[model samples]
Target: MNNKQQIEKMTDMMSKFIALVSYKLPDDVENKLKELSDEETNPLAKTIYNTMEENQNLAQELKRPSCQDTGVLQFFIKCGQNFPLIGQLEKILRDSVYQSTLDTPLRHNSVETFDEYNTGKNIGKGTPSIFWEIEEESDKVEIYTYMAGGGCSLPGAATVLMPGEGYETVVKFVLDRMTSYGINACPPLLVGVGVGTSVETAALNSKLALMRSVESKSENENAAKMEKLLEDGINAIGLGPQGLKGAKSVMGVNVVNTARHPSTIGVAVNTGCWSHRRGKITFDSDLNYEINTHKGVKL
Candidate 1:
């Protein structure tokens, strides 16, 4: 195909992908939900899990969005210098989201900031936020697509700490937020925690943490340990499915960290609801693609 044809093809693929994730949970998320369901002993929580499963089944059978709030689209991209459509990716993703909004009949979620009006097409100025990382010596691009719903990612929290506060303060910040607003996210949630030198960096890293697989751990040993500690602590809260209280409160806790200034600590927390509409797709130089999040699925 010519360059124009390639671009069109990519856009179509992405729109289909958006539609796919709108209704179907990622494989890891599905399995984790099932695992949580099987382990639960509370009658109410078990019934809630069953209802969630049934909702997915009905959504797939009807080919409709599983949630009423389809969410604002977000893309985290890692593109290689040799990727053929490096320059056109931003436009392509925007176009794809617009197309998906129409084709999937996604809820109109993009309202221009301070302009006070819904764009109706889900594509406004920076509506579908895109974050990028450029790879040096490869010919493939990997993209993580996420639906940041109003109750989850949109309500994420961040804070800066004094030098004496330490990491314990970070834990307190996260737990406090969870206790206050975790139910608003429709738990059990997949929690993403980020620690960096600034609020913006921490917030961005927190979103990146949500893009990871449900079971992924940070490469840093301390961060991994924090993940486990936080997971245990959150589960101890018994937020359960739909925040009704049960055996578990979260799918997992993922921590992502960066070296921070010696005098300061910055922390943020973001979350994904049980449906966790996060997907990873990779395209090579020739545009051959692989779906990493949902197995045995095609777009």
Candidate 2:
């Protein structure tokens, strides 16, 4: 196919994929929520879980988005240096998002900074934010599309602690943030924590951590253990579905850590609500594609 054809094809695929992701939670996430609901002992929590399940079912059956806030589109791209469509990638993605907004009936979430006017097309200066990571060894491009809604974004917090504070402070910081703000984030959330040398790095890492599978664990032994500990502690708080007081506060807590400066330990926390609207797709140099997050996904 020619460059124009490639752009059109990719744009079509992305628009369809965005619509699919808006309405469906991945199979693993769905299963996790089911397990949590079955294991929960609180009546109120159980009712909330049922409501969430119903919401998903209705969204799928009616071919509608699961939530009203479709969220600003964000793409995390890992593009191979030699990919055929490399030159046209960014423009194609921008066009895809803009087209998808109208084609999928996506909510108009992008607004101009000072004018404060809705673009209505979901495309504007720095909108449909794209983060690029170039790789040398592969011939395929992989992309992660995430929808961070208002509720989930509300509880995001970050801080730079004195190095003297140590890892214990990291743990405390996450817990404190969850306790103070997580309730507003629409519970049964996936908590992402980033620990690094500065606030910006920490914030970026925290967002990246959310892209990891809900069932996955950190590679570092210490981090893995801390993940489990936080998971248990948070669940014990009984935040239950939508924070109505239940047996589980989170789907998981993923901590991504890196070496930090001796003087400062920065931490950032972000959450994905039960809807957790995100999807992953990989495309070969030939434009053949795979959608891994949803089962029997045709697009």
Candidate 3:
């Protein structure tokens, strides 16, 4: 296809992809939730799980969004340096989101800051937030799109710890945030923790960590251990689904850590509610696409 034709195709594909993700959970997340439901002994927790399952089913069968808050659009992209559409990728995404708002009737979440008016297009200054990672020696672009609702994004916090506070302090910070705000997020939550040299980097990493599957583990051993410990600690809080009080509180916790300056330890925490509406898509240099978000389905 010519460049213009390719762009149009991509835009159309992304609109459909956004609609699909609004209603469905990723395959891995769906399975994990089912597993957790089977393992839970609390009656209320079990009921919540059953209800969630039914909600998903109704959404799929009836072709409706699972949650009323379809959420603000966010995309994490790993683009190949050699990709033909690299230069236009950002514009393509913004346009796709704008088109999707009309096509899927996605909630109008983006608004101008001082103007205080809905963009209606879901595409405005910094709307449909997109983060990019350029990779060498790759011919395809991989994108993870997420809907970060107000509730789930509430617990997101970032602060720089004094050097003396140490890495353990990071754990404590996350645990504290989870205990205090995890309930509001509709557990079991997927917790994302980022550790770096500065608050901004940590905060960004925390948001990026949300893109990882709940079943995935950190690469560093210490980080991995901390992930397990935090998961245990958060689950013990008994926030349950919709914070009603129950057994486990989080689906899983994934920590992404980077080298830090000697003076400070930066820590940030971001969470995803049980619905966790996110999707993954891969496109070749030619812009041919495959979406791997949901299971047993083709588009």
Candidate 4:
């Protein structure tokens, strides 16, 4: 496709894809919820899981968002340097969010930081936040679309610790936060932990961690071990489904880490409630596309 045609196709495709994300949980998430519900022994938690299933059914049937918040849009893009629309990708995504907001009828959750006013179209400053990665040798682009609801990603916390405080402190910090606020995030949660050199790096890492599949494990053996330990620790809290109590408190815990300054250790936590509205899609130079997170989706 030519440059102009590529841009228009991309914008239209993404608007529909993101709108689909509002109502549908990705395949991995849906499967994880089913697994947790099936294994859950608590009657109340089981019932809550059933209700969540019913809610998904109704959302699909009615063609509306499953959760009321719908969340502010966030896009993580990995684009080829040679992609025809690379320069225009940002505008295309911004326009996509605007179009999706109208077509999906998303809730107006964006407010200016200091001005403190809702942007009715979900198009306020920095709304539909985009983070980019450029590939040098190809012409394909991959995008991950996420909805950060107030109860989930918005209220998350982060901190930096002294080197003397140790990695153990990171464990303690995450556990303490989950114990104190995880329930409020509307469990069972997809917990994302970021460990890096500073609070900002850690914070962004935590978000990128959430973009991975619940079943994924870190390639770093130590990090993978930490993921298991954290997962077990969080689940042992018994916050369960909707925090009503059950066998599992989270779908899974994902840890994304980076080299840190010797004197400092940074950690941040972000959560995705059971109805995590995240989706992944890829497009080739020709604008032919595929949805990676949701199976058999035409868009």
Question: What's the lDDT for residue 58 in model 3?
Answer: 92
Per-residue lDDT tens digits for candidate 3, residues 1-299, read 89999889888888888888988899878998999899888898899999999999998887678898888999999998988888988988988888878877788888899999987788879888989999998889999999989899999999999999887888889988987888888888999999999999999899888888899999899899999999988888888888887878888999987898989999999999999999999999777778877766664
Which tens-of-lDDT digit does each residue in 208-246 have in candidate 2?
988888888999999999899999988888888998888
Local lDDT at 38 for model 4? 97
Best by lDDT: 1
Worst 10 residues of 1 by lDDT: 147-156
Local distance difference test scores for all models: 0.92, 0.89, 0.89, 0.92
Q: lDDT score of model 2?
A: 0.89
Q: What is the C-alpha lDDT profile of model 1 across 1-299, one tens digit per residue? A: 99999999999999998999899999999999999999999999999999999999998888799999999999999999999999999999999999999998799999999999999999998879999999999889999999999988644899899969988899999999998899899898999998999999999989989988888988999899999999999999999999999999999999988889998898999999998998999999888899999999888
Kindly report which residue stretches of model 4 are placed more than 4 angstroms away from their true locations once superposed: none
Error of 2 at 198 (Å): 0.8
What local lDDT does model 1 show for residue 290?
Answer: 96
Q: Please provide TM-scores, in order, for all candidate models, with all chains considered together.
A: 0.98, 0.97, 0.97, 0.97
Error of 2 at 77 (Å): 1.1
RMSD to native, candidate 1: 1.0
TM-score of 2: 0.97
Clash pairs (backbone) in predicted model 4 = none
